[model samples]
Target: MGKFIDLTAADGFVFPAYVAEPAGKPKAAVVVLQEIFGVNSHIQQVTDRFAAQGYLAVAPATFHRVKPGVDMGYDEAGMKEGIALKAAVNGLPAPGVLTDIQAAIDHAAKASGGKVGIIGFCWGGFLAWRAACLLKGLSAAVPYYGGGMTAPAEIALQPKCPVLAHFSDRDH
Candidate 1:
């Protein structure tokens, strides 16, 4: 019931993205990065929330790099497949994902008429932080419960925009 759109990365990799537009002229744009679940219902709802806040929101399907349609739930089989995909993605350098994020950023910028922000959950949370670093045009970022970020000292220095990161001590 939401809007679906397409984006082509610098290397000619095309993928689908979920987008939500604000009522009037957008005050800003937000790139909503999904959890490992892909752009499911929850992710779509979250993007809609950003749209309600007067920001054009978009959530790109990051898994398209590994497979054209890779969405998984938290069930046992889904967990297994998600883990496998994560392992395969580890072989790809960070720059590769960064390229995809850049594509999303560009799309949002054009769609929102310039100003942009980013937000993400779980695995996408780490990506939001990375986008804050790699995507220079972003105005802000919010990352929720991204694991393994603290261990990497390099990421601490790369974020170019204001970042608001939230983590649950009990969960992550």
Candidate 2:
């Protein structure tokens, strides 16, 4: 349902992205950010689901800078590894991952020739919110259980586009 494609960032960094296209014409475009585990099967399935809903979806490999081609499961060990990777990547700097995400957004806009939106889970959720505040040409954003967004500083950032965020009470 989806295929891996490459995208280049503003600084010439190249990374792979999984793109799922709708059968007919796409009504809109969406940039699907991956969880801490990278662009794994679940993320691909989510992208495919968006495609099925008449949107061209693209999930960029945000972890490519630190560890390329990471695809882990939903086990305890996977969670631990994902946490470590997220910490390492987060410590680097701002705009590092954001640049990659921008590449995805640009690709989606080019592919669909219409408004682009974003949706993300966990670590990706934080990114989705950040993108809403920082990136341009976005129609809307949806973030699911973004733990980082709980920070006061993150919440202070204003979004340029409309955002709908989801949080679970049990999540920490």
Highest-lDDT candidate? 2
Each model's Cα RMSD: 1.8, 1.1
- For candidate 1, what is the total of clashing residue pairs? 0
Cand. 1 Cα-lDDT: 0.82
Off by over 4 Å in 1: none
Candidate 2 lDDT score at position 101: 91
Candidate 1 lDDT by residue in tens digits, 83-157: 676566656876776777899999999988978888988888888887887777798999998765676564556
TM-score of each: 0.90, 0.97
Candidate 2 local lDDT, 1-172, one digit each (tens): 9999999999899999999999999999999998888899999999999999999999999888888999999888888999998888887677788999998999999999999999999899999999999998899999999887979999799999999999987543
Candidate 1 lands at a TM-score of 0.90
- Model 2: C-alpha RMSD to truth? 1.1
Off by over 4 Å in 2: none
> Given candidate 2, what's the lDDT at residue 134?
93
